[model samples]
Target: MGENKNIILALVLSGIILFGYQYFIAGPRIEAQRQYEALQAEQAAIEGTENAGVIEQDDAPSLPLAVSVDPQTDQSSSGNYTYADAKTIAINNAELSGSISLGGARFDNLFLANHNVELNGEEKVQLLVPANEDNGYFVRFGWTAVDASISADDLPKATTIWTSSDTELTPQSPVLLRWTNAAGIEFLIKIELDEQFMFTVTQTVNNTSGNPIQVRPYGFIDRKQEPVTDGLFVLHEGPIGVFDDNLEEQTYEDLRDADGGKFESTTSVGGWMGITDKYWMTVLIPDQAKQLAVSNLSYKASGGYRASYLEKAASVPAGGSFETQTQLYAGAKIVETIDNYQDEFGIKLFDRSIDWGWLYFLTKPFFAGIHFLFGLTGNFGVAILLFTVVVKLVLFPLANKSYVSMSHMKDAQPKMKALQERYKDDRQKLQQEMMAFYKKEKINPLAGCLPILIQMPIFFALYKVLYVTIEMRHQPFFGWIQDLSVADPVTPLNLFGLIPFDPPAVIAIGIWPILMGVTMWLQQKLNPQTNMDPTQQKIMAFLPIIFTFIMARFSAGLVIYWTWNNLLSITQQWYIMRKESARRAAKAANKA
Candidate 1:
């Protein structure tokens, strides 16, 4: 009875964890997403009405470019703007394709060449879009005048149309954009692209106006609106940065309500700041040797947010030129690519761009192990299976001790029943006797809970890996399992689509979840269950069903891992039980 209570407590705790996540986190997110979509549609309709006519280049609102000593107070232009069909320098490479808008010299239109919006679709994933589009996001670099003599208009503004040196920008060929102001200050942005997603933007200012000038180079990633996030508390999606080698993450809501709608970091020497989505990110990496201040800001008037950085002002002597380089990383958050960029460019904690959660210690290495297996198998699903086997082997010793203790408890059930019957009238006596019985049998009543407790962190770490990593996006397993990063699509509710009717998400139970429930039930049966209260027994019997429903909304890859882990556990426990029973029978025979 005591052992049964311990098992029941463990099961209840597990249920609470899953239920709390769904109710407190996932449920609200789903509703918020629905509301956000409706709001977006309404905004689109209003924009469509206001922007009915063909908008000229001159009519487009210029993005405000101002540098403040306190980045929190930096302001930007407001009002609606259209994507002007202006001149652009074509950008083509093996990993990315887009056009660099010569106007404002912004990286406004970019797409990941290897990733698609849909599993079977030809349309590529757009990482950055034109400033006028819905959820418009882009990166731009400019010089901020620090001297009172240099006015903002005398520097390059977003309206400035720079002349491009090259017709096309590629990995092999870099482009140089040149612009001059009335003050005889010529601003040049030499853009270079790597084979992957890193773009090197070197800003050079040649001051021909004789008088000494002071200016600070700055870069910013602008998002026209708050994006719809995954809504999972486990995954962060919004403004993130690594300042002073420490990672900081803030949500859109937090940034909006911050003091003056801004969050600033202490002056740090070389860090990266960016806005990140679930799979993609746009980070501004300044020169590693420069002292800079990073900030996350939200503009209520423009209904947009920005992550920006301002470097220490550089003094350009009367005839001397000032040059500073900042790198922009815009693409899918592949772990290897990000790590490589971190190592190659000496970007501080660049891999932190992918929200690895608080369990970075475990989550990253777990991903690395599965990633290694993926390299050999060419299939992420197979890699997950192999990784599970490795995890099981590594934890076998501890689990074996737990299972052996459980087997002993099961073997002593008959004696335990007699003890329970004798003390049924006295609750205190029953408790005292049970403890004595457990001691005599060398059994730990709470031994069964150890395995369940141990699995919780591992489950969370794997879930984080599947939920946040781009490598798992659109990855296929076997038949009908095309995308492992989402819930199983083939549901039995509509006879597996044989009836041509799609069931709602509430009843959308898949085959894998059912298999997991079955394995969980079988594993539970192998545990000691005799002399337990009838209500507790019933509760134990229903846990598998409860978990099946809870996990139905989780990613299929996670469901697969859970199911595979359960099956392995069941096999190990059953073997241990059989061995324990055989040993008990042989000892009795020898005693006879």
Candidate 2:
């Protein structure tokens, strides 16, 4: 039997390594490799986009990075649209392109690495363009008009911007380009990048008309990235963001999220800003280091006011344009830094954030707070144990009740055995009688299990805490259990290097599982089963060995939880049993 159990343990060990490699390593490797090929394709695509303009003008920048709508060439040309139709904006650099539209005001485009765009409408007159677009649809928006410079105190107004496609881009004219002077109405608006990929562009209506006007902004810029799963952590805070040193150091040379150590990973503190038909991006992270609201991995968008959801009222005064500042972050979203940020911008990206009701609200915050406190202590294992103790203490009343009931139930096991023998044939009747007996004696068969069941969330939450958190990566502990993430080294894998499994955290060959199984068997004997039959007894005894096999290759953290829980439980049971035995003996002696 010992040999058979060792054989099973070996098989389980092999399976874990194989599964880890296949699911976590191999698959991501393949995807990252594929992304490398795609980034190369993006660079090649630029050639086709500029071929028309370059072929016409021999003096054009021989190499192509930015794509533009050529007014120098005829607009009648035709070609398939590719990502190269968009200019490659190095995430950390500031880039600007000024274009004078046909009989239009000169639009100066400025890109900041901190996820924001500043349109300095000086000397140039602003035009208010009504945004005509669909519901929940986000886009870049601006207006068209002759020079109409207006003063700040005067009612700011401008002519509507004509659109070839949808006039619904803005329900009314956007209020970004507010007039600083009375020199006609200077039209202006700004787009704020919300958390993650969501964009919120706002144009306030500043007016003394005693009424509020609401408008939406719209425009378009094509975005592209070769997808890769493996890299330093990624945080996508959309408007407000952050990044660790490792992630910030990535470059866009290959323009892919991941490469075969061949491509550079990059971050765009400022994403992309579209001016009229032209687009600009921040090529580097220089001045965009400090920020205002919605802090994430990168810096903040310090240029604008952090708008409120409820307090702002989401309304603008008529005749007066609304003023707002916006920031954008376009780059690989490092998940580790995002989680570490702990703000709303980072929290919304987690998969576990969407859990329901009171448990969802309470659990995530509770676990995160515990992690924060324990992470300070420099040991996750110790933190987990501390967290467990706190939870147990909070639920002590229920535990006390369960323990008392179990004390009664364990003492009655002899009587229950006698009843089973008496009603061996009438099983249904036996169950009814046993239930009545329990009610009469106030002995609960399910009492002890209740505390454990109630405590299951802490166990499961700790599992997620250990599995998902990158902080625990390669973290070491006392010898044998070097890494808390994996099980303690007790069993050998290769067994003389013959089998696939080798010694990991486990040190002793195969003693731990047998010992664990023995404890389980003893616990079962100490706790009585009132309504159980011969078949039930078989199952109860068999569970110990079954669980032993299951836990042999499990994580040290999980084993720690169970082992401590069981040992503590055993001590409690033994104390209660001894006291009860003494009490009965004393009562009998007094009666005699």
Candidate 2 lDDT over residue span 1-592, tens digit each: 1232334355445445644654466557757778777776676676564433221100101101121122111111222232222221111122211211111111112222332222222332211111110001112323211112321123221111211211111212221223332333334443323233222344444445454433222122211221232331211111211222212222322213233221111332322221111111111121133221111121112111110110111234455665443333222222333344324333222322212123445456555765665677777666666766666667767866776776677667788788879999999989998999899898776776676567656655554455444344445555555566554555544453457665532233333454566776777677634554576456556767666665665556656656656666566667766767787788779999
How high is each candidate's TM-score?
0.90, 0.46
Candidate 2 lDDT score at position 253: 27
Stretch of 10 with least lDDT, candidate 1: 54-63
Using lDDT as the measure, the top candidate is 1
List model 1 lDDT by residue over 1-592, tens digit each.
Answer: 4544775667677766866777677778868888987987898797675653222221112223343432222222332234464478998999999998877787889999999999999999988988755566888888766657576667776666688658999989999999988878888999999999999999998988888888777888888777666676788889888777778888988887887676676467888888898998998898888877444444445567778877767888877898998899998899999999999988888888988888899999999999999999999999999999999999888888887887787778789789878998998999899899888889887777677667878889999998899898999999988999999988888889899898767568999988888998988877755565687778778889988887888899999999999999888887777888888899889999
What number of backbone clashes does candidate 2 have, counting pairs of residues 3 or more apart or in separate chains?
Answer: 82
Give the lowest summed-lDDT range of ten residues in model 2.
55-64
What lDDT would each prediction earn against the true structure? 0.80, 0.39
